[model samples]
Target: MPYSITVNGAVREVDVDPDTPLLWVIRDNLGLTGTKFGCGVAQCGACTVHVDGQPRRSCALPVSRLGNRQVTTIEGADGPEAKAVQAAWAARDVPQCGYCQSGQVMSAIALLREVKKPDDKAIDLAMNGNICRCATYVRIRAAIHDAAKALEA
Candidate 1:
């Protein structure tokens, strides 16, 4: 069946199996590779995306699970919030391996949207599942803080 999903900001019609993961559909069908596939399960936040403004693990999220909800991937993640997060990520040098940055940035945008000024504990709680093998947690936290500050001002 063909599923009409709103990805980024455009409504794209993808003819794929209902059980197919959103990550694959976004990558293969949509030709958007910003969302990574760290783990097929939801344990890894590598395939994190915004589903109706919520951070979702796209790797495990079935295409059927998404309806009219707006699915925002790294490619489609824009606006002042995304720019702030991107600026913070660059300023703090958040990525080491560069594989997890997109997911991390997506997660951070979600976190910042919810918690305008997230503290260490809040950041930890929000970014708990997203793992970085390069161990850039410190910088990620700093970038989140910086983004919050920039958004605050």
Candidate 2:
């Protein structure tokens, strides 16, 4: 079946099974590979993407369920929040292996978009499932804070 989905502000059509996960559709069908696949079961946030401005686990989200929702991947992420988050991540050296950073960044963007100045508890709650094997939680937290400050400035 062919479904029309808006990704990164563009309406894209892809022919795939209705049950196919959005992650594969984005990566294989659409060729947007920035959204990584860590845990296919959705336990890890590596496959996170913004579905209608809310962070969602793409791996578990079927393409049929996407409908007309706007999907934003790491490749499509932009704006002041994205710019600040990217700058903070780079400045703080947040990524170790970098496999999970895309999801981490995506989650961070959503958090910052909702909460301008998220404290430690809020950050922890928002980023709880985003696992960094290198254990860069401290740096991730710092980068989120820095990004928030940058947005303020």
Candidate 3:
């Protein structure tokens, strides 16, 4: 089946089964490899992407269900929040293995977009499922705070 979906501000076509996970389509069909596959069941946030500006787990989302919704992966993550998050991530040295950083960044950007100045509790609530193998939670929280501050300035 051929499905037409908007990704990264562009309409893209992919030929695959209706049940094919969006992650594979984004990575294999569209050649966008920023989204990672951690837990296929959606337990981990490695496959997090923005589906219509909301963070969604691409690993569990079926391509056919996308309809006309827009998908934003790490490759296409832009704008002020994205820049602030990326800068804060780099300045705080947030990534260790670097595998989960894409999803982490995606989640962080979404959170920052909704919450201008997220406290520790809000950060914890927002980044609940993104698991970093190297256990960089402290730095991740700090980076989110830093990004929030940068956005404030």
lDDT of 1 by residue, 82-131 (tens): 99999999888788889888888998999888888899999999998998
36-84 per-residue lDDT for model 2 (tens digits): 9998999999999999889999999999998778999999999999999
**Root-mean-square deviation of Cα positions for candidate 3 versus the true structure, in angstroms:** 0.5
TM per prediction:
0.97, 0.99, 0.99
Off by over 4 Å in 1: none
- Sorted by TM-score, highest first, which candidate order results? 3, 2, 1
Candidate 1 or 2, higher lDDT?
A: 2
RMSD of 1: 0.8
- Candidate 2 wrong stretches, greater than 4 Å: none
The local lDDT score (0 to 100) that residue 151 gets in candidate 2 is: 95
Clash pairs for candidate 3: none
Best by lDDT: 3
